[model samples]
Target: MRQAGLTEALSGLDALGRIWRRRGVFAIVAGAVLALAVAALVLLPVRYLATASVIIAEQEPGANTSAAWAQKVGDPADMESQLLVIRSPRLLRQIISSPGVAGAVVSECERGRLLGSTDACQRLKTDVGAFIDHVESRFSVASAGRSRVINISYQSGLPDVAQTLANALTQTFLEDQRTEGANSREVASSWLWQELKQLDQQLREADDKIQKFRRTKGLMRGANAPISSERLTSIGQQLSQAEAARAEAAARLQEIKSEQERGPTDAPSVLQSRTIADLKQQLTTVSAQLASAAGVLGPKHPSILALTREQASIQQRLVEEMQSIAASAQKAFDANTALVNSLKKQMETAKAEAGSATLDEASIESMVRDTEIKRQQYAELYKKASELETERRVLRGSTRLVSLAELPSKPFFPKKIPFLAAGMTLALIFGVGAALLADQLGARLISPPVPVTPEAPAQQVEAPAADEAPAIVPELAESVTAPETATPPPERSSHLPSVADVSILACLPRLKSLREMSALGAILQGHQPLAIPRVLRLASEDTDFQHALRDLVHELGLKRSARSQRIVVTSPDAGDGKTTTACALAEHLAAAGRRVLVVECDVSHPAFAEIMALPASPGWLGALERGTPLRDMILPTAHPSLDVLPIGATTGPVGDILDAISLDGLLAGLDGYDAVIVDTPLPSQRNDFLAGTDWAIVCVRSDRSLIEPAVVTVNRSRALGARDVGIVVTMTDVEHRSPPVVQTAPVAAYAGAG
Candidate 1:
């Protein structure tokens, strides 16, 4: 459904072609608008511009050096800030105060309003601002890409002025920078010298504090801040070594014990002299005891004492071996204890030495830090002194300005071509808009003719045979009356003795013999309504029907009044003989010498150019499009009695170019004209036929046979407040018989008889 609606809308727009075809006046109007716009643009003043550029560089130390390094040295923001200051109001005033620049600007602006007061200086200030504005508007500043070199360019109408201003500003800024650079160097040198004195005093103070602190604390050279971190680390390492030695000794003792339990006979120190000699002495005692016991006892005397003595000798040998083992064990314990104690003592001594050395190292580091601080201060002071000396050397030279500005050769203005083109294009758009407006308003003035067809009545005849049934039945009725209203005086009523029944009756035709009689005197007749002009709108392109209707209205005594006798012919769509019919009807009126105004109301589209062979210039739409008045648009035609108001000043959307109200006003404003014959837009294309028009004659082509459609269109026109409706059949070859005339009694005859 949406697609269908879109299609319909496109179709409606397509239908506008008819309007354009008929709207010749609007074309003229659009052309005029563009032409006028072009003319206006051409009359404007011309302007030419020229530009010049200069490069500024930075000053160097004690020599004519490239500005590249200095330019790079300053921060970009700082440079921009300085540039703004160079272009400051005070600086501008100073520049303009110069005799050369001030006289030139005043001379240049002489054609304009400038320099009239004792405060010409003040006026010059305003002019200077304008000059700066103009220059800035044209001027540009940029640096070479990836380089420190800057280009300052100025543009002006006068080539000489451009060059002069560019050179002058560049020289002025350069000189100013030089002076500023020199002053900066002086200030920097002065500041550095003053700072050097303070710095020297501070250096001495810092040095004295260091020396006094060292002396008061009795600190040795190379002493630094104190901490026991390194000492503790050394102590921890020694302690770890001592623990490993003690663990080794204990493990050896346990291994010896375990081996003895496993039946090892020798002691860890068995080979030593002290343990061996004690073991041998115990053995000798045992042997002596055995010999003494044997001598006291007999050989076979069963003496218990001798046996016990022998056992004792053996036990004594065993006791000697055990005693030797115990002695070796004690020696081994003493040796291991001695070794452990030696390792522990070594560890303690190392810890104490490490701790003391750590403190001394810290103190020495403190002295080294102090010495470095003094060295850094000396170096910074020397560098500052050197920089100050360099700055002083660079500032000793003088600088001078090279150029001054001159009068401008021309003023810079915008190009007029684009502006003119835009204006004309805009006007054309408005013209088309005006056409749409006129179309939508339905203020069209021309109409086509409507065809009329007369219906024939059917005939009836009496039957020839008597037995034939009657075509229609006739019925009779009796009247009833009150008794007091019935009189008894009549003799026939008394014989009947009652009221009579009604009976049906038939009448027969009577024919008389043909006889000729002498005619009586004739009377004068009064004027008929046929004297007035009457227009019949044709529904089809049926020339027969169109002529028949015309004859009918004529014979019916119907006509338009003399003042409003003009008629307009048009159609609802194009290809209808709106123009052709208009020309033909105008030709009819021109034959009678009745002045006619054949106004081409369809300004956007015109068809009358072909019909009338009109000069086709100075059309209505053209005048309107050029923004001219209605009177100027009215042009005389070839025929003396017929003047054509061609369509002109039409473009854009129909709505924008022309207004229905304005068109009506234009028609009403045409009071002096006799009769107007407007060749208007198709009714389907626009409603111009209904715009306060006297009569509308709708024309249709004959072959199309459009009676019912024409009726619908005419009815629609009537609904649109068109009281005077007429139709014309065009492009038709059919013939029509004349309508019968009707007779009426004379009003003058009655008056005379009385």
Candidate 2:
């Protein structure tokens, strides 16, 4: 009864079996799809691919060692940039317009013309630009991994055309790189030469400016410095020498004055004089003669008087010579002082001249520095220009063609084997899907077979009167006199089994059996067969039905752990006894000392109120529309523990109301019940209410329901979040039914049952 895993496996197998039964349809669909695929593959034009490889030469000619090392490592970004360059519109335009490429394009167009593709041929004849663009679109450039190799691939309907275009593109790209490099270097050399000429002129202008500034400001150079600075230095040195001479002369004059005060004989000029020395010697001799004569001759001494007069004459002469020497020293001091004063005046004049020339000299020095810088720049540019001119003559391209594109022997597209395999796979999938869809649509569209009832034989009775039985008297008398021989019922063939025998009813749990009751049938004669009172009366009269419902309740209790369980009872189709089963199950649960609430969610065709003989009061829909609490709308039943919330009166769209209504919220509001049994419409109609419920019981009629739809309903319930799901077969022949047995069996066993 709880074989969920087994149920899913059997359901899959049953679906496959059903699909297999429609193999004719599958074959037709698959064959059609495969035929279409083959046609498309055959109609598609074959294209040939040609590839040419080129190695990006990392180290260019005349590159330095360090530059070569860096280029060898190769930057991926640089490689990407090169790829873009190869694919650039300008480069592509150049390549496509070349003579070789144009010839190839013409050939391809001619080939297309023969194949009935006149559009490309017309474009070529009428518009050259569009033709070129069309040709460029056929080729692509991409780097080969992280290496410095680029692959130029061209695709066309003709193999030779593809090869020719690919090779031409490669050759053109290499030539373009070389031309671009040479043109860039030539332009640079020309610009450098012009710059060098301008610098040379500027240097000459600066030199002339410096010279003109010096001449205007009298800043003429003298050995190491300007003339004004040299003159000032010379004046300073002469003034120093004049001041020394003046100081020496003043000391001598002062010494002469001191000597005149103490007697002019002590003066240096007087001491060095020869005239004074000769007079001093004569004075000494005369004094010595006077002394000797006075000592020899007494009192009269005529000779001593003569000697004294001679010595006095010599002293007078010596004083005159000293006076002359002092006059000369005064004259020398006056001359030296006048020279020092004159030198000082000249030094002031030189300093004033030097200060005026300082600004002029600074300006000249700045101009000379500018001239030197220009000269250096001119020399450098001239050298670079010469080198560039030399290198430009020998410029080499940075790429070389490694291999020419080869003409492809086979077409690249419409590969027969792989395309066939893929087409077959897709065809099978589409075929299976179509077959299943057709089968499901057929099942839903075709009506189920009506149950056949054998006609009852008419009884014959005595004729009441000739006139009353005038029309049927002969027939009744003949029937009563006829023999009791009746044709034997046709024997059923053993080869073909009845649908009921192989039905999925055996796979599902047989929940309940109620023998056809004449009394219950009489009560439900003019009303719905699932009328509430009829189900109630059947439950009370049928002992096995009560035990089956009790067993269902016990199974629910064992499977669920929630304190309050929410169970949804639904069927694959309407009138499958879902309402009866829901009500009966709820009653049994309530009878088992558990409070149960029955929520009738089938608002589209509500019957609980009318069938249960309850008053027509507003139920869940009206309460929801009026913003009334659902608990207040819950109607009490005969069983104190059982309650019913019927789909109330409403004029609103039942589908919209059901979709917008929150079943969980409604149940939560009616809180006191231990279990809530939600009786929903057929699962095929409305299954949203099954989400978040504890269990789903799908009811099916054993006489009419098929295995595929019932299994689908069970699986759908599980998919919609029903924690536990099971099927309950209803409307069985209770008289001939055996006692209920709960066990698992293979689907093969059931299929083979008689």
Candidate 3:
């Protein structure tokens, strides 16, 4: 179905092409339209525009300022924070209040308000939303390409305004950035100071609490020490050893000291005391290092493991050293104590060694030296902590701005030329469509033309020969006469006279003689004589009219006969004009003339009188009706050249009339005739008159028939037969110019008479 539709569409397009070709004016008109369009386009001026670009640099948030949190929140939230600060009432107010910007904005706002309202400054500030709005509005900030740069461009009606706005925007942006940054930095610094101070307080409080806790819990410097089962067990074993050693050393030392206090022998006591003190001090150092290592390197550390190993090694060493020291102390104490004990035992022997008063004062000086060493270590650590805090405070002050916007040099607006072109093009298309629509709706002319064929020519066909009688021909017969003039006379008219009358009068030709008139009228009626045989037939069926017509023909001597009768039988009326006269006249004239004959061709209404008249071997109608030899119709007449015969019975309901072709045969059979008068029916009322004849004369009535009817009768007879003949105009008025004379001539009899 679709394919059929497409085929039809293509056919329609072909037909449309034919239509367009025939109506080539349409194409010319369309071309003219297009040409005018091109002309107009050529006439239009070209326009140019200048452009400039600006970049919007993205300012990343400070590293420690929750930027990661801002990203998870999306750009709008971050941008809103940025936008709020940029478009903040205070900031917008600040821009509006700025040096030059304030006056310009106030003037613009006043102009705007003047165009709208009356309140000045109050309305001005309210309308100065235009400034914030202008930057946020005029400034188009879009992320350009795939980069982090946002493009910010400003456009205005004027290029200078565009440049000014661009510059102003860039300046505003820098100021906004700087102000925001400085404010932000100041706020951040102040916040940092507050927070840092609070945190410091917290730190000091934590330190104080930790210190107080350490002091209250007796955990002084070894607070991080582990007290796992294995370490505790090792510590317990070391403690037990130390305690045992101390107990033994104390026993020895006590014995020595007791001896020193009781008696005066102090060397052994002092040495024992020094050895105990050195051993105890070495043990304390090892214990303290082990605790420190345990605090520094928890239970899982290699250092802790090393500490444990070292502690174990130290425990053994300390035990051995303490035991060795204690043994030496014990020996000294034993020796001194034993000596004292022995002296006590020998009470009197010990009494002599008791002088010990000088030793106590020097020992007091040694105690004071140890107290000085502890105070110096505490002072060093406190000073180091203060320096670290001061460094931290200064590191927070340094901040910098990294991005800046530059001013643009052009506006991005109007685009008037392309817009106008588009509008005009659209308008032209619509105009063409309207023209086509109007053309379709209006009436148009239709042309009429003649048809043509390849085979046939264009001339009109010839009508029938009978119809051709009216058609004019220029020919003459010797038996008749020539036309006196080439053209006919015009009738005179009495109505509105004009020069047409004079032209008509000038073209009329003079009349001719009666004989000439008769002959020429016969010729004009379309009868043409083929040869110049001097015989005539005045043939008709009616006798009286025929007799008169015969006398007229004889007076004219149209034929020659012995009896002086050359009758041309004719009619004044049907059956009234004598057909018998044709026979009688022929018989009378042929007495002196040569052979004469009567031709009978009125087959439908035959009036041969073969029964009434004398019978013959074969009659004229017998020869004609049977289509037999015309020689048989040349029966014996009284005249020589003339012939007389009677018509046969009616062959059919109508006469076998002669036409152009059949007349040829009828006339061909009359080759021997000097005079052959044919008897026929009346032609006016009955059409079988003069069916066959050599020449004919009409037998028209004098009173009853008009000359015009008689003339038409003569014309009609000439049309049917009588190629060379004349009208007798019988029974014409006696006052006519030449009255008819009753005369007869039989040329056949005339030949016989000679």
Candidate 4:
């Protein structure tokens, strides 16, 4: 597990190293990209910005103008409305048509088109609409942070132009607001004046109608207040008073009459008579004189009698005046009673006139009140009209300017630090992307396409050539041969494929020392080939490698019990010790007394002739061309029961020699061999040359072979009739190298599944 993990880590490192090595390939191109980015940042036009702010004050109570319709300050809706007014097209058009604003926008456009071939700048110079659009695109209006202030901002390449345009827009907005306000006031005044005239006419009609109603109702005016039903009530009250006065006078007169009936002097008025008072005073004076005379003369004196007579006369006159007073009182009582009756009839007449008129006193009173209300309304309308007329001349809008735009000292955009930073970041990304693209294009240009084999129709052998050998039954062919000399031993810690799909027949250890070979007896299990017979002894050597090799050979014999046992050996790529593996397996079987043949079909880089130290000759090919017996072509090997058959003369790129001689006939000639092993080059390259073999001994270079291509080769071998395949992994230097696994086991079985 540790070894496999190390192998994956090493593979990842190798991939990274390959990528790192290509870093310099695109460095110059990437630097040019960055340089262009820097130039763009430096050469692009800079723009200046200017802002003007205005505050929208809250409306005061009791105000009656357009300003009064405004909401309180600090309200979002109110702030938004102010911004809307500033940004309105009508106001914007006025600002755009300002004396210098349009010219500045055109100039900016002309500057922007300096490098272009088009006459857009020339066209815009004469067009106000294009200038206005440009101005609007650069201008911005927004409320300032939840406040009632609205900010008007403008951007331009020229600092003075930005400031002038901003100030102009703010000023234009204010003037437009004032103009609208004045127009609104004038309209309101006109409407109010017309209303006042109508109200005045209504009031006059109401007053005149009230008078006509009073005349029809017979409700006359009183001395203090108007006379209506209350007048009738007053008349009734007067009648009642007159009746009460007449009753009191009559009662006094009756008492006086009673007194007069009893005696003239008994009358109350006579008792209170002024004539009796004066006459009594005179009689007293006369009685005083008579008493003086009687005192001097006799009791019947003339002076005394005269005094008495005068007193009686005064008493008589008093009685007469009392009677007269009582009669006057009776006359007064009668006149008062008649006056009361007249007043009561007058009251009844007034009520009858009011009732007959079909206008009740209450109705008349309501009419009077309504008429007064009309007069009051007319007066109020007159006052409001006058006020609006005066206000129309002086009314200002709700918007007030808090500040005007100032000239900008610095450009708002194309700042040095920020632009450079942003440009650098973008250039870095594009540079890397461009570099990778260039590398890919270069690789595609450098490599050529490899030709893949097409699916050919099934056939054992092609027609014989001019130098042909006789054809024979391919099934009658015996198995292959082995080499005379020993091949290279399997390296240490060798990786082998799994024994599941393809049984790994052998996994030999590295023969680093005598200690490593001490357990050779156990690994060979008494079947050590004569090619490697001398076993060096060691002191207490580790035998784990012995168990591994023993287990491999045991598994091969146990698993490979089926028919069609002719084994073909190949690799996915070269340098996998393909020939060495075939030779070793054949040697092991032959030394065990099982007759084996190892045929070297790989003429391009054949190892069998070299390993046997063969003299230069045509090998099997020359013998066939010479029509020599097939038995003589079979060369003896160092192993008593093993033999080698080399591919003669070098086969051309097309390998046409194999077509001239019957490979099946040659194999059939090996009738005595117990088993056959054919050593060939990569199967994928040769295509399907060894299709007759039932099983394969595929060699894999441990820690180096790509499993995917190896798997492809194995699958292709299966398609070409090699079944019951076995793998022999070689050159595995696991003790010191990476990917130190014992075998190139099935990828899924070893990939963390356990």
lDDT of 3 by residue, 496-600 (tens): 111111110000011112343576675463232211011122222223333343343343344444332222456546532334345444544455334556666
Error of 1 at 224 (Å): 20
Q: Best candidate, TM-score-wise? A: 2
Q: Least lDDT summed over 10 consecutive residues: which range in candidate 3?
A: 500-509
Of the candidates numbered 1 and 2, which has the greater lDDT value?
2
Q: Rank the candidates by lDDT, best first.
A: 2, 4, 1, 3
Better of 3 and 4 by TM-score: 4
Q: Each candidate: what lDDT?
A: 0.49, 0.69, 0.42, 0.61
Q: How well is each residue in 1-754 modelled by candidate 1, as lDDT tens digits?
A: 1223433454455447535853664576677788877776666544444333333343444543456555545456645654575566555555565446655554444523334544443365467676565445544555545343455556544455556555555666665666777777778767766776776777677667666765654443433332234444555675676566556556655655665566543445333445445645554565566456568766554554555565566556545665555555556666656765766676677567556655655665676676567567757866776776776665533322322434445454545667777877877776776666665455344533223333211111122221111111111012221234222222211100111121101111111111222232111111111110111111122233333333323321123345644455566666655665565455434433566677777645665565455664757656655766766666665556666777744454455343343335556666666667777653443345365765556654433422345544555554444535554444332211222122222233212111
For residues 545-580, what per-residue lDDT tens digits would candidate 4 score against the true structure? Answer: 333333344444423443324677788777665765
Any runs in candidate 3 off by more than 4 Å, and if so which? 1-147, 181-185, 202-417, 443-754
**Model 2, TM vs. native:** 0.53
Best by lDDT: 2
* Clashes per model (N, Cα, C within 3 A): 105, 1, 55, 15
RMSD of 2: 18.9
Candidate 1 segments exceeding 4 Å error:
1-36, 39-43, 48-91, 97-99, 114-122, 125-159, 166-190, 201-374, 384-420, 438-754
Order of quality (TM-score): 2, 4, 1, 3
